[model samples]
Target chain A: MKKLINYTPSTATRLFLGLLPFALLLLVYMGASEARLAENPNDRLLPSLTQMGDAIERLAMEPSKRTGELTFWQDTQSSLIRLLSGVAIAALFGLVLGLLTGALPVLNAWLAPLLTVISLIPPLAVLPILFIAIGLGEASKITLITIGIAPFIARDIQRSTQQIPTEQLVKAQTLGASTLQILMRVLLPQIMPRLIDAVRLSLGAGWLFLIAAEAISSTDGLGYRIFLVRRYMSMDIILPYVMWITLLAFLFDYLLGLLNRRLHPWSEGTNA
Target chain B: MSEPLIQATNVGKTYGQDVILERVNVDVHEGEFITLVGASGCGKSTFLKMILGTEQSSTGSLLLNGKPMPNEPGPDRGIVFQQYSVFPHMTVLDNVVAARGFQKASLTGLLFGRQKRQARDDAAAILEQVGLGHALKRYPHELSGGMKQRLAIAQAVICKPKILLLDEPFGALDPGIRADMHALILDLWKTHKLTIFMVTHDLKEGFYLGTRLWVFDKLRHDPQAPNAYGASITYDLPVSQEGRDTLDEITRQLGASRPTIPYKETA
Candidate 1:
């Protein structure tokens, strides 16, 4: 046998190894669920796979008792609307602010300290203030998500903007570019791919803030559904909802990665 | 004599207490290739930056055609650094085309439709002349050091600046590639009648490429405060005809300094 360090896995073996842990987790959950149910048929801690499937069908296919709407799709839609709106606004404002502060020394000096202080403040602590100021409607939740991630994105963009080579800027100026031209032409395009990457990194935090706000106060959302069902210990519904959320987050991440690679081929290929 | 295109009087620069260059005065006429040589940290690059207008001389004045050099970098002055001077996001063709667009257009830094097609044709012709026609679609990262420098040269010259500044443009290339670059630069300089200022670590390169050569070194040295005195143009030799003795003197002086030796003494 080859030494472990020297041995490299083939493509097929690598795929199998990647899937092993996930399969093991599934088996463990199924076995524990069976044992619990065999001991007490009424145990709600671990729902059998079939029970979770049934809960998913009911939530996905049937109308809710009170609202007459499919709770599953409704919750997903509401949560997605909030998440997208907040992230979109953050991206727009972040790009503008980051571009200005990074390219202009005066703006950088004035705003860098302020941005640093704002990023340092825990966004969740400000959630209560946001609810009081903006109210506990869709606006408050969206603002929470926006406030939670915009600074991070802006700060990231500022750094990437600053990181653009001085040579490139000088070259542009020598070509007779105005200050605004250099910003839009030389600096802006270079940092754009980086901005997409920064947004990708901040998505996880965005999801967290979204769920926190929804769980605290919301009539409809993925987090609201999960928290509402928890009163009856319906692990069947909660587990499937959790699985759904994970799938959505995974899909989002995959799509963003694809967009980055597609739109910014140079950034992905090699260092400049 | 006709007026010199560029004139300097008592040019000096300092950052805080660190004096980098001082009391530098020279006159460069049109179409003269002036190469600068100095030890590392001797402010050769600093002097080039001053000429490029990215940096200003702190103490003295520099003139172009009997007027002050523009405070902001403009189309009259084009420059190429050793590396990282090309736009990686753009393909070779776009890099050259963008230079023109940046100078002409007010926003988006782009030309569209008929103007865009015209720009592309002009860029293509220049790239072809630089032997980069085949790689017009390639990004900067995809090209080798030599090719990137070619692209840089193409970009610098596309705007037809009155002066071209190269700061060790070929320093990172291998010898075989450097020779090709030297030929290309000379050809371009002759064809375009460009007034060029280049800084090189290699003394032989300065001698071979430039009509006139300059050496930057400090006359005084203080042990405790190394930067108390700034470097000045120690030797201004016309390398086209009488540089042998000046080369020997430079090599001997560089040998004695024991550090920052940019050239070797030849027996």
Candidate 2:
């Protein structure tokens, strides 16, 4: 008998297999939603597609009845700004600290032990502390995401730096490079693509911290609006908001992947 | 003669309780091609590291240009390892150009405008010499083993260093390709006037390539403490003058007891 490992699927068959689960999921959801709606037209638990679409249009396109402004867009903008600002700051600090900690033993001695403890602490556990210290404004939310993921990113970069061949470092020095020049010229370019990979890995945790911070103490954000509409049991609005967040996460991951491929063609398949 | 381009006196290296190399002594003048061969676990590579300045000798002094060799790697010496010799992120041309960056540039190791063009031209010329002229834009991973080694040699020599250190450079190459690399290295040695130190497992290769052949072996051993005595240059033979003394003796020493020696295994 042929071994299971030996049976490689054709590309077309692989594509079909990839989409089968999602297709099955959607079909099941539609059938369940139909049965619920047929039983009770006012059922909010599983609103029909049209109902959800109308909710999305109301939230996204129309101005809110109370505030005379588009609440959905405002929430999205503020959330994106806070998330991006926090992630950007984290990535910058992560790269610098990682490169230093990874390349220089002096800095590694000073920071690595502390970073281990910081990375282990749950960011949500500090939500109350951040809100009190940085206040209820955007600072607290941004600080939450940054504090949540910077250590992981820094640690990843440090590991990647250490993985570089000791031979290469010696070669660089033999070519008349100083310690700083070796770090900037040799290690920096190599570690940049690795840093991007690390950031992509951290995005899930980043979003978690962002949403958790918003849910606890925020006037606006995707999480804020979800909690706000939960008081009325508005499943229609909640469903659409969730799908929107998923779409945004998928888009950002895809764009960042595309950016990595474009910026560092040689790094392709390295992690593979 | 001319203060010997490099001089080593009672050079030794050890860990906390284990000796790796001991009492390595030799004087190498300019344009000498020294090929080192030994059984596995011998300290030939460690000696190379000491000369390369990454590993300082635990005792005694290694001198270059009549002064004690710098404790860190400097532009006067270049090395090519068995693998990972070239930067994966750089194209064949850029790999050599980066050597120029280390040589002339300050902190950033980057050039601009006229300097960039000049560096590129110099790199291209060296690449052409190494037979990588057609693959200048190809990254290291895209190249085959021989081509990558060629690129390594080019990068190592581009800065016009006085010494070129190669550690089993052609060990991974096919026999035919290894012959080609031998010719290329010999041609580069003469044209560039480089004093070469190459480590090879193949006895024939050391005889064929080097003006002098060094055999690294431990003359004494303690059964209780395996690493009590480290390897030293047991026999330093000038290949050009005395290669025919006895090839059989070396093959016996490296092959009879140590059946696992890389050269005999492959041969």
Candidate 3:
């Protein structure tokens, strides 16, 4: 095998690069806030480092008061459950629809217009109708995510399935492989790299939609906590929660990126 | 004598308004190495396709082992294409073992590990035969052009088909590698006694490896027309035994003052 040049950054290097900016910003903010607090201890806009540390301790100690504490953890858990289940359901639907549309031209033509129309309507626009039909509860949020994500996944899978070379299919047929056999042995293996890429894209989109969904209507969630803190102009509490959310998102994204790299080593050079 | 392994009677093919081949007749005997030499667009590949059952002959019949060919590809005939046709994602072993997926190898036999041992053994043996024993775990992208061609040949022959069809298998290789592959093919043929039908445009290759050479002369009739007929026959020269002697005599005559007769036809 030919030796490939190693120019791409390793995972540890990427993580360090991603976190450096936030660390620097936090240090500058800490120094500036300390000076402001020392000048005017009673200023509503400024909070001392000790006061911010006290707020963190208080939020951790009293889980009942300060809607931020209860709402953040509750929303985080609910959003995760809905995202997981919604992804499962959407993948099931996408796999079937993608397979059928890829195998039959007539079905693809018939479903093209309907899928386009459905995909065109923004999930936010359909939120009210979803709320009216299913009430303002977990169902609404889960359904919103499912509708938002299924089309993109289906489209990605269908295009990937279609892009497999005809020569490979012909070779499989010459080997006496049946339709199912060909799909399982030849088509699936060839399209797996593309499918994993699509799934990673969908995961990012799913998180974005979850935040938007939680921000719209919810008694609890990380988004709701951030919004509630903003109303009182409490940057101390809001900044920490924002830090937590950013850290979580980064963790998920980094983990998925690692999985993608591990599964497809050939894709590393193209992933910049 | 028994019947030829493959017989084509008035086999014809037409694509819409264009006639590719018409009334083509050929009989391939067992263990006979035949080379079909033709210029491009002479329908040599189409004829091979008809034999492989990948394309339908619009007019007549084709028989393999004195039996009618089905509408799809079968294991009775194995084909090696000119381009790299191995599966890119599969290892060399998987690519070779895939040909047996439809035969006695059952789904349960494959899943429960009954066929794995046999497949590995067979793949190793065939890879050794084709000088690719060390490349069993390598993918297609890791192989060179010559190695890829050798892998294709090994994959085709691993199925043990009755007739092996090669469509310009060596046209893409360099001259040195092509010569080496030709010698390897001849050695394998001597041991396996396979009925080989190859399509090549190289005249020297045809003279070296073909038991019977078919020359497709396009300039026979109308020189201006693109479509022309051709002829072929078994080379029945006594030079098969005394080819070196004949070359020496020709050199001696050329060196002499007297010009030798160049028009004498020998058989």
Give the candidate number with the greatest DockQ. 1
Report residue A201 deviation for candidate 2 (angstroms): 1.1
Which portions of model 2 show Cα errors greater than 4 Å?
A269-272, B257-262, B265-267
| iRMS of each prediction | 1.6, 2.7, 5.5
CAPRI docking class of candidate 3: incorrect
Interface RMSD of 2: 2.7
- In model 1 chain B, the worst 10-residue window by lDDT is B258-267
lDDT of each: 0.90, 0.88, 0.69
What is residue B243's positional error in candidate 2, in angstroms? 3.9
What DockQ do the predictions score, one after another?
0.68, 0.61, 0.21
Looking at model 1 chain A, which ten-residue stretch has the lowest summed lDDT? A263-272
**Residues B171-191, model 3: lDDT tens digits:** 878888887899889987788
Ranking, DockQ, top scorer first: 1, 2, 3
Candidates ranked, most accurate by lDDT first:
1, 2, 3
Q: Supply the global lDDT for candidate 3.
A: 0.69
lDDT per residue as tens, model 3, A1-272:
43567566689998999999989987987788878877887654656667767766666566766553544466567667877777767766776676667655788899967876777888778878998999988788778888888888788888877766555555555555666677667666665666656666787667666677777777776666667778888877777777677787677667877776677553332211
After TM-score superposition, what is the CA distance of residue A144 in candidate 1 from its true location, in Å?
0.5
The TM-score measured for candidate 2 stands at 0.97
Off by over 4 Å in 1: A1-8, A269-271, B243-245, B264-267
**TM-scores for chain A over all candidates:** 0.96, 0.96, 0.78
